[model samples]
Target chain A: MPANTLTDMILGFSVIIGILFLYILSLTLRFKQEKRKASLKNRRNIA
Target chain B: MINKPKLLTVFDILTALTLLGALALILFWTPVEITMGPVQKVFYFHVSAAWAGMLAFVAAGAAGAGYLITRKLHWDWVSLSAVEVGLVFGLIAILSGMIWAQPIWNTWWVWEPRLTTTAIMELIYLAYFILRSSLETPEKRARLSAVFAIISVITVPLTFFSIRLFRTIHPVVIAPGGGDSAFSMTPCMLRAFLISLGVFTILLVDLFWHRYRLAKLNYKNQTGEN
Candidate 1:
């Protein structure tokens, strides 16, 4: 139970959380892009 | 325009709350291990992510089988989403496991059976995506990817059982008989571990749903359909 092990724990948790954040961000950005594309296509079809 | 389902909205909130609760338990409630210390706490989320990744692969394989039987587009979407999400989770598990190992195993990497098999599993799924991208037609892509997904999932079980089957230094936390576990769990540690698993399971489902929606959107865009 050395105090230095705390650094490993922090690093481990940071990596996990950081990856999840990047993933969710990707999903969100992709979703928004798709929605915009779909809407523009619909607008052109109506015009 | 695709509408987000109300149930998914509810699920998103619930999953976030559960994940926070799991983190609280892992960090604050669980007692520190005598030998491994704080780094051992990473074990809760590391194993849970691995479990979730394995579950995702199973789901992908099942959905692939479903597509082969039914020739439905939805099944293909499910298969693709599961595989993609599974890859992300698997990567997290591997990286986190390596971090934990550095402190405990005195090394950052090892070519142990469990580690090697898991790496192979990740590569197989990566190959699945490559296979999909190389195909020209949607039908061919779907069909080929489905078949690949089904066949590659054989690695999942092999990866899971590798430690049990081989003489590896990797710890077997949950085993049928008393296993060569590196450390024994106290009741609080056990509770935190289970909670982390449950939260990750919920998170998997939530991510899968979002990924499936993205796949559906892509399919619609490809087909020139709203």
Candidate 2:
């Protein structure tokens, strides 16, 4: 085998992993933000 | 704070372990192709992502139909979450497919039926979001988006069969009658491919669950209901 396509394989895997990581990060951040807002809203209603 | 389910946590660990196992099998177990060399390894994840995306779209369509039949808000959430997650997997498949194509096809993209239909399917789902955003009321938004989701999913089967239906350079690995696939898979290669598909399926469910929770929270927040 020539094995010359190492670069392309690396690029493909990097892009797949990178996109998944970024998406998970976005989901986590949004979940936290939403939770905080909901809590604050509950507190205000109680007050 | 909403308590995380114990089963979800267990599923998270399972997905992570299976994904790591799949990667190790691809890197160390599968033999390198004499012609395509290392880049052939990309085939495992590339195909897996595309399969997962297709499954997600199917689920979304089913959920849409369920919403229409029952008029339940949970079905609406499931439909939206599946589409959203499906978009991510679709993007991965397209980008990875492009990378693989550049080396094999000597071009970044071609107007082949498979490629063209996949792009169109992605666009249709993208429009699904735009349609949802345009509506103000929850009832109207869910109803309209559910209809759109159901109709748009007709493209999923079209996209899947495009290579078989048309003359194209894209490889069809699992086609009937041993269609025009560029390469044949050995036992080890087949094992790795199956493992990758399984891992992606698990990941899809995990992400869909998370996204559904987010959608539920957003719905509750918007309507100020529990």
Candidate 3:
């Protein structure tokens, strides 16, 4: 029988997916933040 | 304000679905290696991520060339976006590789040639950001950053051939006679591996496009705002 590395496999996938998730989240947040800043600048200029 | 393209939305959905399908196939369809067991499965996406990361750097280098010839910030956006997305994929490859090594190598880290070269390559690209932020103007930043990216790309091929050049415990998956670190793959395993590579490449393109758009927006905001 091969050595059981099931825990390591799980950990590997989790880390891979977790990193992707976090990066995607950060990308989305940056877009929203940029949009908000644009809106605020527009409002100031109108005033 | 730029609106998101409908085609990009469709492409994003397809990429996500393909990624899920690829993961499921890897987990369920590929047979476990009798020697290494389940953890051998990590090799599929692990190597694929590394491939995507390298491809990104190459794209960045090509974009750098485009910037130098045309002097367009659009190419700069491509270069910057590729490096950013490349770093993420490179980090994923390194971390996933460490996990795989833990069980196979009986350690979390090693000073082996392949591993060391990879870490160095990642660090070289990471410095691209620091170099960009130090410049006083956008044109200066883009011009210098393009040169840095073009020069730093040497590390990619160096990292790639490290295992072939020197003795290392790292697996030589693509090398012939794959001594020591090589494992023979069954047909099913090969199919899954190819699918994973395709999926990751698509993911890399999607991420680069999104990032390029973000770079454009960031540039617009920095320059257009009073």
Candidate 4:
């Protein structure tokens, strides 16, 4: 049981950590986009 | 119009700190199970994912109710975001369970109550997205999706109870006399498990807040352009 599962452990850990990294990347991209949009709106108001 | 609030930035830092702490606790501090050995480490994250998945589903249901009462598009966005995130977490839970099971259960798939019910719940969540995608009008999509979200949540409790019942009838098949899904944890293991749950919940809240803010900004942009 334990012998065959080494790969499963690696796969499971990878998936969990990979998903976390993906979510963090997504958040960062979203923050940038929102900031740009806000700035654009501000410039529009000034013009 | 506004940046992420100060509280959210603080949450981002807290989330990072807690997640790193959880990893350290699980990888170094926790004891391995006698029966399951190293693979048992997956249990902490599996259970945590399940918790966050259910929490997201409940949030979707609540937001659906709010939309119905208020008839606000923002509530619809909240409901949609909750369901989307729930689907992602729920998929992780199911796949992680299957991966863990293959080592212990000698099979990649099981008709066990909990496993089966979770699979079914994931399906219902997938259907929610499909239902939303099929609609063209935003107002109609919001109303129909809200209705679907409310109606779909009814199956969650039923799925849970049915699985509990399924477990009762089947003789313990996989692990031992009690059941196939049993795991015995030492104090360190238990602490690691609890810590993982806390970290996952915090991560879920942080993501939800960000998703909601993005949706709100998109809405404001649309309204302003119009």
Which lDDT tens digits does candidate 2 get at residues B1-226?
2567899899989988888888888989899988888988988999999999999999999999999999999999999999999999999999999999998889999999999999999999999999999999988898998999899889999999998888998898886567557457889898888889999999999999999999998888888886
Question: Per-residue error at A5 for model 3, in Å?
Answer: 0.6
- Model 1's alpha-carbon lDDT is 0.92
Leading candidate by lDDT:
1
Model 3: lDDT equals 0.90
| Candidate 2 chain B weakest lDDT stretch, 10 residues | B175-184
lDDT of 1 by residue, A1-47 (tens): 35469999999999999999899999999999998888888898899
Q: In model 2, what is the error at residue B119, expressed in angstroms? A: 0.4
Model 4: colliding residue pairs: none
Q: In model 3, how large is the Cα lDDT of residue B179?
A: 72
| Residue B185 lDDT (model 3) | 85
Q: What is the DockQ of each candidate?
A: 0.73, 0.79, 0.78, 0.49
Per-residue CA lDDT of candidate 4, range A1-47, in tens? Answer: 34445677788888888876887688679767876887798799989
Pitting candidate 1 against candidate 2, the one with the higher DockQ is: 2
Q: How far is candidate 1 from the true structure (C-alpha RMSD, Å)?
A: 1.1
lDDT of 1 by residue, B43-158 (tens): 99999999999999999999999999999989999999999999999999999999999989999999999999999999999999999999999888889989998998899999
Runs in model 2 deviating more than 4 A are none
